[model samples]
Target: MLTHLWRWTLFSYRAIWQIDIRARDPLHAARRAWDIQRDPDSPATVFDIIDEFGTTFRVDLAEDNPHLDAQPILATPPMPAWMARLLPRRFRRHRIRSRP
Candidate 1:
């Protein structure tokens, strides 16, 4: 119980920190990490940002997007544990059968 509480506390702290950073300048951070850009001339309906590690993130800020709420920003094909382990810790949690 104590160990689980500790892990949850650490995760919450990290998440809150990220939220604070994003609150300051979300678009800049997004662009720096994933190369996503919002153009005044022609803003992309779906922002695609690819990280240096080749991870693609799709961002949909439009409220009309049908799957906007439910869709995972970085959905992955169902993969086995061994394959999923190769992914980042943040992504591994979304894996079909990922184990911490």
Candidate 2:
């Protein structure tokens, strides 16, 4: 009976996205998480989440950092649509421009 229930639960379970803050230095990670949690409007620079099952997921700091402007060129405008289409499939340009 237990085996049958477990199988049913597993089949019905949906994966949830959570940040797991289990770094080499958990204290630092915890502090960062707390800061983000405290300020609801604060942009999350670093954090992790744990699921109900105790599974943890790491949120990439580099990807989350607002200061790090590394958005994909395809996502941005200013590049001519024709030029972007003309570029080779293998070529990807995502350079960060310095602001004056």
Candidate 3:
């Protein structure tokens, strides 16, 4: 059996994320770690994010854990026009194309 886990910390203006995946059978921890590094957001895994105020949020796909069923917030962060210009042209085009 293999399982994935993640722990996150939030600082004043930065976020630190760490992930660990291990097996209960024959696979070595190193191999399990490699699998997790390849795709941190793969299906059937859990993701967690914590804020500075000690608020913990979790999204689990495992049957033994609780599930989150809330609607997503559709607001975008405010960015300066000049700062947006620093991104690659293709990324900017994709962002603009995705907007309604």
Candidate 4:
């Protein structure tokens, strides 16, 4: 699948970090963001997340910090409207192949 560089904005009482994650989409990026955040203290939380198209997502992290809402926010999908309009139907439906 095509990998996009996503920005995971981490918010903590200690500090804030803009973590970069490469993944197929925002959902994958959110998962990876939690994984990346494991190294830090528990105070750290996902403040904001954005896809390549810059669409913001409200990622609700669980108490254990594993599970998340199926829909990003208000039933919004990972891909943004702008991207959906830009890409072809097939490209939007199926993931693009990525090179090693």
Each model's lDDT: 0.45, 0.46, 0.48, 0.53
- Tell me model 1's lDDT, rounded to 2 decimals: 0.45
lDDT of 3 by residue, 40-98 (tens): 57553555544333334555555574655523232333344566688887767544421
Model 3: how far is 24 from its true place, Å? 10
Q: Which digits, one per residue and each the tens of the lDDT, describe model 4 over residues 1-100?
A: 2234333543322212467779999999998878777855554555555444334555445356645443443333345456566887877766432211
- Our tally of clashes for model 1 stands at 0
TM-score of each: 0.22, 0.22, 0.28, 0.25
- Which candidate leads in lDDT? 4
Better of 2 and 4 by TM-score: 4
lDDT of 3 at 28: 78
Q: In candidate 2, how many clashes are counted?
A: 4
Model 2 pairs whose backbones collide: 19-48, 19-49, 20-49, 20-57
Q: By the TM-score metric, which is better: model 2 or model 3? A: 3
Off by over 4 Å in 1: 1-43, 64-100
- Backbone clashes per model, in order? 0, 4, 0, 0
How would you encode candidate 2's per-residue C-alpha lDDT over 3-86 as one tens digit per residue?
Answer: 678645722212223345755687888776676657767555453433333333444454535332333223222344456666
Q: How well does candidate 3 match the true structure in TM-score terms? A: 0.28
